[model samples]
Target chain A: MKVKTVAEYVASGEKPEILFWVGCAGSFDARAKKVSIAFAKILSSVGISFAILGNEESCTGDPARRAGNEFLFQMSAIQNIETLNSYEVQKIVTTCPHCFNTLKNEYPKIGGKYEVLHHTQLIQSLIEEGKLKIEGGAFAGKRVTYHDSCYLGRVNGEYEAPRAILNELDATFIEMDENKTRGLCCGAGGAQMFKEDEPGDKRINVQRVEQAMKTQPDVIAANCPFCITMLMDGLKAKEKQDDVMVCDISELIVQSNGL
Target chain B: MTIAQIIFILLTIAVFTVAFRQFKRVVDNIKLGKSEDIAGDSVQRWQNVALVAFGQKKMFKRFIPAILHFFIYAAFLMTQVELIEIFIDGFFGVHRFFADKLGVLYTMIIGFIEILSVLAFVSTLVFLWRRNILKVPRFIKPEMNGWPKLDGNLILYGEILLLIGIFSMNGADVVLQKLDPAHYPDTGTLPVSSWLGPALFGGLGEGALHMVERFGWWLHILVVFGFILYLPYSKHLHIFFAFPNVYFSKLKSRGEMENMPEIMNEVKSMMGLIEDTGDMSDDIPEFGSRDIRDLSWKTILEAYTCTECGRCTSECPANITGKKLSPRKIMMDIRDRAEEVGTKIRSGNPEYIAEDKKEAGATLTIDNFDDGKSLFDYITNEELYACTTCNACVEACPVMISPVEPILEMRRYDILTNSQGPSDWLPMFNSMENGGAVWQLPDERGAWTKEIEA
Candidate 1:
């Protein structure tokens, strides 16, 4: 399997419709790597002309900026923007809400601007446009509940895209106690994933998992790589890992389509 | 002029002077903050004011409290009609001047206010019960320990006093009208006080009823004056600040933190993207917020606007999970420190010195008057680090205050200026700076792509 690079597309004097932004988690984290493969497979199945930055891709500096290091954030942002500008990347899609949010919202101020979309949004549009067909397949009657990633749902105000795909899958889509605007975080945001949790009675991820557990769903659907990792770790802590599966919306769609 | 009119004139002057002085203090305190450009977008800002403030849209999210709040709010507005008449009668030394002039229209207005007064009274009782008896979790948070707890109760008590005055005044007037139709004109019956008034004061003689009416009249106006004087020191100040605060709220997405131009320019220059103009100055740029002066004026305004509702804290994930971070506490701390620092700055400044201090010829030095205190003295490092920056607090705020903004600023000061942060963050920062990711495997960044099919 060969994933084409933006450089290769540029050398051939062609442009990709969308640049697949594989964030650190999607590229390196073992579990999130499966989401990268799933989303890439969907793009290829839909016959969409997309290319990855490959080695050219770097951290979007979201974690550093959130951690209060603006110098490091701009350093990574400026370097990535130069590469993006040189390649004349017009549009981008990512499996990580942190990357999508930073590139779409924070990049314009620092001279990096693009039509960025989350993978869920892209898949939703692809389904609507008849370019992609999703079948019930493996998850027909399985109960699914969505854990809204703060960056995608509340920050970017895109609560519908992931839910829309779930609705298309014919799964028994249930909602958690706190969903949408009031959705709880998986305790992985704000650079919490990289650092140890502050001394508290319980982790935020465990609390959020408890909320998801109340839904009693077979699948806990998430849109961000960070959220997926956090939810899985939460399930393990609750000893519900065997019963409940933590998966990305892309993975759910890939399984539903049997891609 | 009559003696009563003369006294009322003096009282009016005193009330206005006190209110003006206290409000001016708040304005001066807010001006101590650093200025930022949050201007333009007048249309959108006004829409926010109308929808969030005037419409009370967010309050309705919690059904029971919103309904109770609506009753009190409606009563407050309706009471203003009767207030205008009371003040006019005081100024002119006339009893029920509008009753004779406006005729039936005046009676109808008084009836409406009477009904609302009863509603307000009931609502205030329920609010008190919720705070004291039920002990709502939000009201009992550690932040509401002392002055905040007493302030919450005091506001409800004030409302009760106002209601009592309204009922007694109307009740005594109803009896006086029956006894002496000449001095007390027949304005028709008020809705609630008509029956309740006669039931309580009907047995009194004409002279006693007259005395009771005057006493009630004086009590209502005096309590109103007291509220005006006390508002600046109480959380009830939100009654005035919430409108302007919502109007000036940040219009960006909740997740978008303000970009730092100082850091951006320096980083660009360091990268050779921008020219090093050799414009170095004796004063080095400060990195982030250290004191009230280091924060933007909007944040200071938000601090004053906070009513200590604790919606932000209750929704805060860290607070829920038993971490020390409470967004409500952050706003309260900012307000408390602002008041402390603002007072010291004012008493020391020559231009804005108080009249009492001016008389002493106190030419005191203003510099270093903070006694080496800053925001960190109030907000601890443990609480600051506990924030996940999830924007739940930001979303929960009805008046649109962003607690995360100040937390970010303090964190920036901790890392950039003081170079102090959690030891755990050091490895992550190093990974990002050296390897361009938050992990050590830089070369394998694209290894996942190998699993993708063409």
Candidate 2:
């Protein structure tokens, strides 16, 4: 069976072992890619069959739409729907908050529909089902804090899942001054990751990274590539690269997975 | 020329010249895209309060300021008749009785307005006390607190004096209205003047209010003249600039985001062919935010017009998150820098930056070299990179300053020219190049999409 948007993909006559729809953010970044790969391995390790689609995946066009370029953004959206429908794929797990936001919110505006979750949400669900386990948080002397990527926390309201996963790790999980419902922007939203940012206020990333640092955590954990990207830059820019490390929240989990 | 006409014409000419210069400078600043230049505004998320935040119709939300400004703003608008009398006295040498036919009704109208104006003035004085003497922490710096060198007492006294003059004129007019009842027969109908006429002049010796009226009227005329002369120098300058500022506010023309450059523009080319004219907004050289100097001019203007309203500060998620970045402060810093360089625009300040560097000569009086010190220190790379590019500040800015554009542009410069931000972005960029997404290219990241089909 072939389908394009999640609506069509869901209604398709035939389903693959697991319908794999590569999110624009999920398909593009390396760290995110690693997390998704880890997520797939975890699901398979628990006897959940799945296939990851790649060729037809492209940008979700969040950057183009935000930079006030609506024409190409719509075009990208239309093409994405068409391509995804042809593959008969659905149910996407995104690693970038911006892409997640676009697919969840903006896609409906253009008539595409699907079920989506951040990798942590999926992994946490698997863990809840007793299909996944935490091996032990062996790292010590680490005051770790989780950076709530905007899409997962504010946009889609996945506040507990990532925090739950972090909590299970048994590491220090302190909250940033503005976390969860009021998480600070990672400075990479609205397609800001793509275009040039005019100098006005302080760099959004550095400000957020600094906020994450105020937690005085040894590791700044995050769920989105954009947040990870910006926070890492902010850490380096502040010359605290050696002191406070930024990593994918999944990276830590993967490390503890004994993979 | 008559002395009155001479002074009026000369002052008017001077004012016209200054206003024209100001307008021209403002246009040039807009052309440089110096205001509201940040990249996002996700902080100012409050829903409109329905005729309140925008209307300022009621001042209780901020009491002292509301009351004080209510009178000050009202007096400037309401005291026109008082001015008519002032003009009559100045031109015809007749303070009260000369325009006897229209004087009573005119005086009554002026009296009622003055009462409201006095209410505003008295409240403003109270505000000055709270901010200076009591040091109340409100949304903004009250007039007295804004300029510390200013003595709160002196300023409050001046405000009090203005109120006094208003009432004195009101009081004296009461005397005159009762004394010469025939000429000002209709004064009894006015709300305040009617009541005052009987009190200040009622119980006194049969005609004593007449004598007192003459003295009060004289002093009133003098105070009115003082107010006229003091208009330009007083911080009450907002009485004039506010209306114009509102009228000339920059409106957002389009809703969809502006087209981002295809690729972050590069400052230089690998071959000798590319020119680094700062048009780094191209498809080449990865993202670069080299220095403070690379910021767009519009970002500078957003900084200048900040009223320090604290609206942006209150709405910023980063500020809520305990980050040091404040959109309001960003505008304040930029405006402060622009002002420092404004006077000798032709000479170009050494502290200014490349984008808005004024030339050392007239004509093409703009240059590209600003060593970037003092003013540059306020904007840290961390702060610049921390902004989430949310549209919150843009929505909250009453003056229509878009504080996000310049922030994004500078980031672009940093990413393209400096090659500096977080090293992880390099791997992410590589991923975007290959996978067209931020996730692993060939991974089962799409199984969610697959699951939907299943």
Candidate 3:
């Protein structure tokens, strides 16, 4: 039960060179964990070995810092960096854009540094490397749209990797009216996950879900854990949960296994 | 007296009464605030007022509607005395018609602009309603219907009335030409309505035609004055407030809240409160932007001046995300609260307290922020944290309220003393602390920057 840091995850096994630091949202939240595990199992089936570095991880301070709470934020940042350094980590991959974002933009301020990959980005690279092949998903040929999580799309600019994985899954990605960088927030970001939203006329998540549904996607796939949570909740609010499915990009990537 | 004369005099009293009450109320309210007046004696300059108010600097950001709006506003405001002369000469005959050629020209121009205004009003109405019907998450998320949305319908009514009045008066002029072709001369330039009066008098009963002109003249004058009077009570108050809201706009600060002390640990310094000397630093303890006064005076103006355009609602990140927060609602809340509190303050109410009030070594904040735990007493704790501080609403505002500033000021208060923050923020920070990035050190921050091409 000793969850390795990204370095330890990287060096733990020699069979495959990739290491996934299952992001805080991915490790702690249920949907993200499911995607990480499914993606990991898919890699396992393909003779790739990877580790989830966050079994012992603490919460990332992206939420605290953005909210302007410097005291607890710095404290948490220091703790996470110490854990990873002890592992002598050299490389890491994560599924959360916020994780990708914090590592990319904010880590150097406090001195932590690591090579990070979003799982979709890693999968795309893996396929290009000839280590992974584009198998098939005899997808019902129903079109799906990928909702770009902001941290991945807008903040870190990982717009295409998830769609690439989805393409490999055999589902068509029709664009939402608002997509990519101009894409709307899923309402679950900005530390909104913690506090109760005020009662307004329409829930913000529902709006995004509605925007995606308007594309008539058979399923909505997202790269970030928060996006999935928000979209699914939006689907529920719409009572379209049965009609439109929400999943992480990795989950769609793994669905090709059944195909 | 002629029926036109009686109607004119009666309408005059009602218009003045409403304007007087609202104008008096505005003066009385400002007299009560402790904040230093941003607009001093120079605020009375005509060029400055017209520039700030009519130029629509804040509103032009919305692009199309704003341009249309600028014309309509200019037409309504600039053509005021022309309409006054129209009332005077149209019935009373004191201001000689022959001398006022400019008045006729001004009427024609505003008349031309009114045609565009009608389109603008309808388009803006359609835009907001479309957001509602489509349930654009940002538009409807926070608070809708708080300001008694009167802009769309009221503007439509006022524009329609102007059209009726302008055409009827012009129609009457045409009739006047026909009634005495030798006495009245046709200007030839007002091509649209030039033939109307002559045509109407030629066909319709001459007495009824004369009556119609009188009714149009009276109806136009009465409606214009009434709208001006009713502005303060309506969201359309922004028609007046938007100008002052921009001129005294908060120029972006140095990432610091005003009135914050330069040093927190100094002797006898009050926690979370300082008098406004403009310089602020991190070492200063900022309490919650507790009440109406603690906010910038322009922030207060933003409330009073909100056209309730719902642009903020349309752009809010949290509102779109299924969070119960609306940036629009926050503005409305501040608007309503300030009006409620400002009214009390203006009446010389003695129970007033600034956020600067000393209590138990900490400045007493207001119905905002925390009584015990959490930020914001008015909005939910979750809703408060829901803000990404994206500045979309600020950028989107046609009125220049800078909606993000007050929200950030409150966030600073929470971040400084209470250790309160969003649940997710801690996790990101933890990753930063231990691994030096959200992905942690083994996940390295520099790699993504290197990989992702700009």
- Candidate 2 docking band: incorrect
* Per-candidate RMSD, Å: 3.2, 11.2, 10.2
TM-score of 2: 0.55
Residue B121 lDDT in model 2?
A: 65
* Candidate 2 chain A: 10-residue stretch with minimal lDDT: A1-10
TM-score of chain B of each: 0.94, 0.64, 0.70
Cα error, residue A100 of model 1, in Å, equals 1.5
Candidate 2 residue runs with Cα over 4 Å from true position:
A1-55, A58-259, B1-75, B80-108, B133-161, B179-256, B261-304, B347-364, B367-378, B422-424, B439-442, B449-454
| Per-residue lDDT of model 1, residues A123-200, tens digit only | 999989999888866887799999999999878899999999988878899998799989998898888888888888
TM-score of each: 0.96, 0.55, 0.58
Q: By the lDDT metric, which is better: model 2 or model 3?
A: 3
> What is the C-alpha DockQ of each candidate?
0.75, 0.11, 0.13
Model 3 lDDT, full chain set: 0.61
User: What is the DockQ of the complex in model 2?
Assistant: 0.11
Ranking by lDDT, best first? 1, 3, 2
Q: Model 3 in CAPRI terms: which quality?
A: incorrect
Q: Tens-digit lDDT track for model 1 on B1-454?
A: 9999999999999999989999999887788788988978999999999988877778876789888888888888888888898888999998888898898998999988888888889999999999999999999998999999999999999999998888889899888888889988987988877898799988888888888888888889999999999999989998889899999999877767788876777778888999874443455666888888889999999999999988899999999999889999999999999898888776666654444445466563333344467899999989888888888888888888999999999988888888897888888889889888888784577777766643
